[model samples]
Target: MMGQPPYSRTTIDELLRLIERAGLFERQPMVERKIMHYSSLQTILLVGEGNFSFSSALATAFESAENIVASSIDSEDKVLRVYNTARSSIENLESRKALVLYEVDATRLHEIEELSTRIFDRVVFNLPHAGYFPGGECSKEAIKKNSELLSMFLESATKLLSLDGEIHVTNKVGPPYKKWNLEGAAENYGLYLKESVSFQKADYPGYMNKRGSGAKINRTFRLGECETYMFSAV
Candidate 1:
């Protein structure tokens, strides 16, 4: 039987208010514009979504049924322990008819038989961190792991992307995050960097950053200079 239509987790008007409050509505119009684009009925894949906060926003912002595929590497148990979000929260997405898959590694996406033939209009990965560390610091090992993960993800995801489609990856703006070289990593996978805009919490009103992995803070206390990098197949 066909599942019920999914409900949005948030609204554009609400998000706009948050962006305006953060004083980013003008300076970061790029990401805001992208968020607006999601309101259309487009096929979307939200990868590396921990606790599915951003994914939930996408569902709320989107206007399609079973069009948003939200995936995370961790299993339900891990999501519960690390994110403190009940299994029902994640299960509710599926009940809403959004395809919510736990334990789906973005890098190893080809392994998922169901997703093998899918072509998404928008593929998104937010704050692609290996996990939280001392004060949200990513060590050299964490840096390398993230680098490899991003590279593999770009390579795999590009193959499943539709033409005229775009891939979006957001990350911490500085330090270990910048070292991953998001644009460079995409280029290595035959993808071209399109545009990048600074990320603001206000831009996504109902969205929350769940660091997961035993992290103390849900939102990492950092310099608060995150950026959303967009890319497309070259």
Candidate 2:
């Protein structure tokens, strides 16, 4: 049986916001940093972008997105229809010469001739979820399915990595997500966790976290506590 979809209940981010409003949530102080992990000097490939705003933001930050390739699993028509900001974001990337692709599946990236022939310094998948499935997002089946997606992605991504290249996945930290056990899954695919860092949305000025699937596909989600897991070939 299909499980309850995400956002059907109070999300952790929403709960945290309520706590903050009540003067009880201890929030971490935001730190200012000059250098972030991503750079225009390195070849970057972004997969599963809902609306491509994140890609556009990166391009703006670097002042050039020539070294970046952004892709979405959804078709151009769907993206253009679902995301109100999609047109402008795609235009921004294209204007900056950033390659924008549609119908790119993260799990089978190695099969794409366009991506297979090239190598990238960084292959990024931000907040990857397998979407709604049987038993829902919190079920063990959901965790296993999501883990399989990550493992397959890691296997495929390894083929397109340059020497010393890395694969990055930023996801919410807790509950069924934590149960995904991505670090362990990465090891099965010959990847080792290089580093895990807190994911601060403020780091990317125009980036917004969208549901990316189902009825809430066009809406943004509350990102409570998230982390970026960096992995490289072992």
Local accuracy by lDDT, each model: 0.73, 0.88
Task: Give the per-residue lDDT digits (tens) of candidate 2, residues 144-219.
Answer: 8898888888888988999899999999998979888889888987888999999998888888888888888889
Write down the TM-score for model 1: 0.75
- The clash number for model 2 is 0
lDDT of 1 at 179: 78
Off by over 4 Å in 2: 1-35
Clash counts per candidate, in order, are 3, 0
Question: Model 2: clashing residue pairs?
Answer: none
In angstroms, give how far residue 76 of model 2 lies from its true place: 0.3
TM-score of each: 0.75, 0.83
